[model samples]
Target: MEYIVEKIGMSRTITVPSQAVTLLRVLDAKVCEVNEGIAIVSYNSGKKMNKTIEGQQKKYSLSSEFNRFVTLEVANTEAGDLDLTPLADAEVLKTTFTTKGRGFAGVMKRWNFGGGPASHGHRMGRRTGSIGNAEWPGRVMKGKKMPGHYGNIKNSVKNEIVSFDAENNIIAVSGSVSGANGSLGRVKVAK
Candidate 1:
């Protein structure tokens, strides 16, 4: 099964080592419709959305303001209890919550491309050097690392142990997730 989650905010570190805490918002997930080998889980929203979004929601009963939905293909159907109450309001869906955006960034920050010497009088410092050869190649090769969009990509982080509050029904996952606070995150099982 898959879940649709949200990037709520970063949590404060409670234990040792001092690592940043990542927070996720897991709505109540419900089995809307199951057909073929796919389970269409609805994460439903109470807010009003645009016509296009409303149409999609009506067609699928998807929960959430944004078009953030995950499809899970069933490998086999066995007699089991799939606890989906977490999708309702208890369990914080765990997934690598990508950011809404990070604009163009240099290789140094993006790919950790160690910038050139800072005090060697080298002007090429911090710049992606030698994109291609002189005349033999004639053009920049494919898959060349360069400055570009930094974040906003869905990255699945695995095995985030979660702690839930029985009273409040707020699920807390350890470590940093991603994205700015209150951004829509598509949560799914980590493979």
Candidate 2:
């Protein structure tokens, strides 16, 4: 019984493991649709969702009112066994989502390249150094490390235990999860 939720915000003063805690605000997910052995869940507010979301809203009337999309998959049961009465009833198995994206980054930030000197005619600072030979092959080698875009790609992190607060509906995980605050994320269970 896995699902997804949006990172609403961070709790100002929540204690975590090492030192003090950084509470991550995640709303309870809504069970949208169940098919085969999978379930499509989401969290979104009517205000923030676009027109494309509004059209899909009709299919997920049973879900909560939040402005994000999350898909889920169930184990040991088909879609027929899905219970819609208790919307919040679920178990966390895994979370899948894109990480916090750092777009168009250099080798320094992207690959931890030690930049060159800041003064004295060192112009190639922070740039990827020589990639290939001059005339042996006459071209840059394949799979050479270079500056490029970072993050903003599909990622799946699994086997995270869910820590939820029944009173306030706040959910936390054992380790740090990906994506910036308020980014959409998915949670799913193995079938």
Candidate 3:
């Protein structure tokens, strides 16, 4: 089963001796519809509900209108039923989320290209030089590293569960997770 989560922040555990962990809060999700092995779920955000969302909530018999809806493929079990309760018991989970946006970046910072010498004679410093050859293939090859936008892309990371607070609906996982604080995340059992 999959769950919609929010990144709380990163912290270090005192007992673990310098072990860093990222905290994730599981948002309240209600199953709206189920078909075959897929389940449609919805969860509310901080924003207030609107009329259109309210109608969808009423149609699904949900307590309130949710800000977002996600479809999750149910993991097969011996009983041939979708078991969502195992999400809390999972020891390791794979999280998918967007990373922090770095905006526009140069080749030196983005691709770690060695910049030109910083001497007075050098006209170009921290610039991508020799993009293409004079002859032979004449054009810049595809997939060549160039200066452009970086980060703010979907990323998935496997994390080990450090601890879980079921009462508080919080989970602590080792290592850094993607996205900034309060960013939406998707968590599932690591395959």
Candidate 4:
């Protein structure tokens, strides 16, 4: 099953030394329409609402808070509160989120290219070294790691479940997930 979750920042477990974990909060969702196994779920997100969203809310007879709608595979048989029972048994979760954007980066920071030498001779400081090819193809390689848009891309990672607090709707995952705190993302039960 898929659920909308928010990144609640990172924390460490209180054991021998410590173990890093990322906390995620599951947003309350209502199943609006169900067909086969896929359903259209509505959940509260930001405060930005539009006429289209109001129309959807009116159509579904939902309140103003449930403004954002997304289609997900749900365990609900009919339209109502989304079934959270599947999450209780979820051990592995596949999280999908957009990474923090680093606009127009250099090769040193973007691709981690060892910049020029520390000495004061070469002029390769944070610049692309030699991108031109010998004259065979007469063009830079297609997949060359040149500076461009970095981050803000959709990334998916699998994390093991550390703990789940049903009362608080919080989940602690063993590894880190992308995106900043309070950013919304989707979590799928991988196993």
Model 2, poorest ten-residue lDDT window?
78-87
Q: Model 2, residue 169: what's the lDDT?
A: 47
lDDT of 4 by residue, 21-63 (tens): 9999999999999999999999999879999999999999998
RMSD of each: 5.6, 5.0, 3.5, 1.1
| Candidate 3 lDDT over residue span 1-191, tens digit each | 68788999999898936799999988876666677757777787778888887777777767764666668765532322234566667889999999989999999999999999999899789999989978889999999999999999999989999888877778899999989999998998873
Query: In model 1, how large is the Cα lDDT of residue 102?
Result: 70
Worst 10 residues of 1 by lDDT: 73-82
TM-score of each: 0.63, 0.67, 0.86, 0.96
lDDT of 2: 0.58
C-alpha lDDT of residue 126 in model 2: 85
- What would the TM-score be for candidate 1 when compared with the true structure? 0.63
User: What would the per-residue lDDT of candidate 1 be over residues 1-191, giving only the tens digit for each residue?
Assistant: 45555566766665776556566655655454557757655444445556776676777554464443345543324312225444344333437566556789999887888877888588988898778888877888898899998777777665354565544434467676666776655554443
Error of 3 at 19 (Å): 0.9
Better of 2 and 3 by lDDT: 3
Which ranges of candidate 1 are over 4 A from the true structure?
12-20, 44-48, 52-94, 114-125, 135-139, 189-191
Q: Model 1, clash count?
A: 9
* Model 4 regions lying over 4 Å from their true place: none
Model 3 residue pairs with clashes: none
lDDT of each: 0.59, 0.58, 0.81, 0.94
Native RMSD of candidate 4 (Å)? 1.1
Residue pairs in candidate 1 whose N, alpha carbon or C atoms collide under 3 angstroms: 22-175, 26-93, 27-87, 28-87, 28-88, 29-87, 43-63, 44-63, 45-63
